[model samples]
Target: KMSFGTGHHATTFQMLRHQGQLDHQGKRVLDVGSGTGILAIMAHLLGASKVEAFDIDDWCVENGNENFDLNGLTTRMGLGTIRDVQPQGEFDIVLANINKNILLDEMALYADLVKKDGFLLLSGFYTQDIEDLTDHAKPLGLTLIAQQSKDNWAALILQKKA
Candidate 1:
């Protein structure tokens, strides 16, 4: 299979595990820092109606494109950070498995792109980072719903309040 994620990293594995619990059918998804486009590609395979992805690195964008073809999926791929992208619309699900600083800095943008009650899944931080991250996100109308951690790395599922 086309490998955007080798399922090795703790953050990616936790993110994927949580993603399995959500209903992706007909949902719209945003995979920020899409890396190899693994999350985006998985979103498509899980039946998301719209899967959009972007990364700041040229290599990631290139490799992501190749991975899409390998999976026989067509994803809207681009090169940019989440901060630089314009709002398309609120999404049903947003995935950000990037590091703590970026997650903290871009939390508001991520929250804004989520529809009311939509899910925002985040990772690529340590367990110690949760409080700081959630604290920042809460005031922006996000409620920490669930969290998982593996090997000092952590993931969280937040929902936009209605």
Candidate 2:
């Protein structure tokens, strides 16, 4: 409905592929740019306690809600912006599969949303963008813990430092 992520793109695929490495059990999860709600649904299935997701696209919001219904799982889906999300009190795992510019602009917000040592999974950028992203993220309390790439797309697993 929105843009990207029907689980067919390289960024989405790599995120799902590397998902198992992190512990999602009983964690609160947040999905930004939550396309078809794939990652949100997956997080819930992985045992995330509360899964919340939002997208700026009305179609994505509608489609995400439908997907949640289809999966028999309930996720808080709506239209939102990064600024609307008060991540500080809201999540333990934050997933953002957006383009390079948005990723850079909101990395600090994502880092703030996660609790100490909580995980933030990011993708939707080419491999060359990692250095700039990481450089911006380091001082904001996010540390690169893992990364995976395929066909020029890169996915990163970062943890908020305690």
Candidate 3:
């Protein structure tokens, strides 16, 4: 299988670091726009019991599946837009690494998929975009917990308040 970690932006690595510290043991995770499924694979490695990922592109879905298998991850991969997915239940953690526009548009939906006090990690935005994204997320019951940046890219970790 082709490697999925080739030549991506440095921000991805930063996000991975934050994800590493979280306790994924027996947790359920959802990875949206899971390009190469890297984040999902990482979640599995962190001891998540189950990981489900989706992408709008068939190629990404296929590659993500392959990567998951290569890493011995039990993650499920599917092809569909995030809006098309109807999650069976709230997730312990949610990872989204898509563009800013899509992130903002889907904020409410993402909030609903998170369990109370669950973690929501979002990337694919620049530093300048944080305020707008946070402002949009506020009404959805998400509060900013942390932020990380590399180069021009940024990642925000939000939590659903109890």
Candidate 4:
């Protein structure tokens, strides 16, 4: 199994557990703020044809790569900001486990990167922050599908309108 090798919060793992069985067969996936790249690796396990991950911290890029190898999953890693990273093409699914402010700021970009009817999964926010998050994302044509909360953290699943 892959380990974070740092005292990171358990929310990331929780997000993975709550991500129900998905049909990612031959799908394209993008993981933002990939950290240890657990989510990206999980995407591959779920049968994503291609998984690309990005992180601003170089250490994360290295650690993520290590974890990917540990999991025996192949993925592409890059150093880039969420605002600067352009999606090569529309993805079937996009996952962002980031803070509320950053999520709000980049919601439009994330929305644009997903194909119509594609899904966007977001975590790293509190349940109390959902209203603002939903408000920010709605204008971009995203609809909330489900929400999973643990303690103070919450994850939201959204789908881009077709």
Q: Which stretches of candidate 2 lie over 4 Å from their true place?
A: 1-3, 85-90
TM-score for all models, in order of appearance: 0.94, 0.94, 0.93, 0.90
Clashing pairs in 4: none
C-alpha-based local distance difference test score of model 4: 0.81
How do the residues 1-162 of candidate 1 rate in per-residue lDDT, one tens digit apiece? 333455688999999998998999999999998888888888998999998899888888888888878887776578998767764988999999989999988888998999998999999999999999999988999999999999999999999995
Please report how far candidate 3 places residue 162 from its true position, in Å.
4.2
Evaluated at residue 22, the lDDT of candidate 3 is 83
Pairs that collide in candidate 3 are none
Write the residue-wise lDDT of candidate 4 on 1-162 in tens digits: 333423256467556854554568899999988878878888888888999898888888888888888878766578888766676888889988878888988888899899999889988888899999998888899999888788778888888995
Cα lDDT of model 3 by residue, 63-159, tens digit: 9888888999765698888778766788999998888999998888889999999999998889999999999988888999899888978889999
Cand. 3 TM to true fold: 0.93
Model 4 off-target regions past 4 Å?
1-10
Ranking by TM-score: 1, 2, 3, 4
Ranking by lDDT: 1, 2, 3, 4
Q: Give the true-structure RMSD of model 3.
A: 1.7
Find the 10 residues in a row with the least total lDDT in model 3. Answer: 1-10
- Each model's lDDT comes to 0.88, 0.86, 0.85, 0.81
lDDT of 2 by residue, 5-83 (tens): 7888999998887677878899998899998999998888898888888898888888889888987776568787878
Candidates 2 and 4 compared: the better one by lDDT is 2
